[model samples]
Target: MADQAISGDRVSGIEDESDLKRSITGKLLFFYVLGDVLGSGIYVLIGSVAGAVGGAFWLSFGLGVAVATITGLAYAELVTKYPQAAGAALYVNKAFKNRPLTFLITFCMLSASFAAAASLAQGFSDYFSQVWELPPPLMIGLLFIVVLAVVNFIGITESVVANVVMTVIEVSGLVIILICGAIFIGEGRADFGKLVEFNAESSPIMAILAGIALAFFAMTGFENAANVAEETIEPQKTFPRALVGGMIAAGILYVLVAMTAALTVPIGTLAGSDAALLEVVKTDILPVPLALITIVFAVIAMVAITNTCLVALVTQSRILYGMAREDVVPGVFGKVHATRRSPWVALIFAAVVVGALLAIAGQLAVGDPAPGEEKTTALEILVNVTVVFTLFIYGMVIVAALKLRGKDESEGTFKAWTPLLVFGLLANAGLLVYSVINDPTSLIWCAGLLALGGVLFLLERAFDRRRSESV
Candidate 1:
């Protein structure tokens, strides 16, 4: 059955004939999903979740893992049914066959990637600040994006290899936090009672819901794995286990890390901090020197952020390249570099948009606020925008999965339980609606990004019409 699908892809000139190199094996792909899912969100947003739900924030992580896994089941089934890049957009296009709706979904995915990369870049700057007080954070973030772009331009094999190395370093940092927490418990200093507590200001239900919205960011990069299907070796055989298995592993680690942070540090301290895990390390439970551990963990946090950002760039480029092949966007985006075989045009475009977003966000966040004004930072705004965009995309993917069910009932193709996909769709919709209601400002950012996508869509249509007339 797998052989039949591979031959069909070649004859139909679908993804198997793609110019992108197929260097991602089952092992590399496993690390790719694990690394991407375990990236910067936990490092940077753990405090935000703590602030929302107090010491019991690990419950939110647990719930988020459940929601994400449900969505992962949908992705596992769809990628096997129609193994290709473009991820959600491709699935939607196949299910609905609506060009405009397909373009909207594609742009939403692209915009989400842009916002996520910018958010991670901000996180990288925050961690870099802990190491040295050299350049301003905005400058550091801009430079970070440029360096990752260069790494991406080199090749997918190189990029995935880098992600694997960085994944190890970042996971080590989390393990250290867990070890420190255990030591604190053994010393009879931990407040295990706090683990069940919720924030006093909000109802327990609201607090948990809000924390899940933020924690969902940590579970996102799993879907990005779908965009690399064309580059993966034997995707039908490799993706189901790798994608779902990686998410389960990352989810367990996230919940454990959250528990450790709450155990080792005071809830007030963890809630107040931006680097929550670093605070856990600062408990001095570990025998290492305070300064040495702090600096080492800071470097590890930056590496984690870099790994996620690199995978995002890879997803964004593949999205454009895939859509272009379908004539849903400009043909130029479909062009691949001769020697490198990378989607050079799409890669550069994604990098520039991310850099521009950072610059614009920095400008908007500039200037001191009046007393008691409580200004929102660029990172906070981007994080909310990313969550909103991703939730909507996940919901649509589940819908697409339902629509495409039984369309290609080939043997060896994975199938998610129908009822689970329905539940996942509702969960995503609930979170998305809740987020927009609480933070209406995110809607404005989403609107602006979608408006830009609309403009690009119109321009592409105009260009295609002109080219057709000349021919």
Candidate 2:
């Protein structure tokens, strides 16, 4: 069992651990969930959805919200059911009890994080270009990683505080769009009916599903909150409410933001540039007399995403450390920070890997993919593979949900159950299949990463077997 501590003046002897406390209430949990799920996937990929689904971008976003909400519902159920700090990887380890299996799941989580962070850093670098023309994408990318690494190494307090401030700042951008969009629509420049335009001209299902992939990125951080259950005030009670409620709220906000953006800007335009929010501000659509307002919004978005990037790295390290502690990877990876009680070794290794990816992306990024050619950038190709790995990890968690049932019957407390988890797993698998067929770039990488994981798993198993025999 995990460590335990007392609450109030009660002698329940059955107290949760006070060491490494998170003090997360339902409200704060909501914020954590909201911030992660409402990630800058919108800021960076608004254009991607626009390009794919054309005029009905809001419909695409709405579709994304639905699909993510389905997965979110499953996550909420599984997390509430188990109430453990390990989350999906923990669940996988508990279910399989295979060192190699857990290692791969943990690695998937870590790899997905690096891929996402690389994307975020790429977004940051792109935005940085708005302010200054830096020729070196690699240098700027490394610089971004360094800043985040430093912040994470400092302490959890700094990371949380930074996330809170950045989330608020970024949320303000959406609110601005909401307000500006309201004004634009009221002034007769934008149309409300466009939000429901399931036109007969195109395959709405295909278009919407394709857009759902982009939206999924915006909704990436829901399961992450489950991993922090150990830190929360009350695992069984606090996590479920926060996890479910927070996701629903974030989904609503995303839909609103999408509608507002779609309404304020021309569909043709929104489909063209990723900086659609900036476009809305520069044009005379909204009531913001000053374009500086949008710039502030952009800054807020960047800060929120940066905070997200940092937190993700922190989560990835913890997952890797936990896996290593179970003897999945090696004893070396289980090393903890003597003073901080954090996973120093994993953090350093993760930073190195991400830095390497950024360096590669900086060197190889090109303007566009050609006919008979793949993406000209290493980062672009690698990012696709990362997404595949991420889906694979999420899929495992869904399966873990089913396997962990009755495995730890001693933890009497619970929320949702195994059936919901199975449902989620199936949903995720379906979507993953769709993504593999539609997005081949990510498909190749997913296969490669899993293959890489398979090789490492065998080696680790053989090494552990030798040690066991010697002992």
lDDT against the true structure, per candidate, is: 0.85, 0.67
Using lDDT as the measure, the top candidate is: 1
lDDT of 2 by residue, 344-370 (tens): 777787787677766655565555656
Off by over 4 Å in 1: 1-23, 156-160, 231-234, 366-375, 469-471
TM-score of 1: 0.90
Query: Across residues 136-159, which tens digit of lDDT does each residue of candidate 1 receive?
Result: 988999999888887888874365
Task: Tell me which residue pairs clash in candidate 2.
Answer: 5-16, 384-442
Residue 190, candidate 2: Cα error in Å is: 1.0
lDDT of 1 at 252: 90
Q: Please identify model 2 stretches exceeding 4 Å from their true place.
A: 1-22, 156-161, 196-202, 284-291, 339-342, 361-368, 372-383, 403-423, 447-471
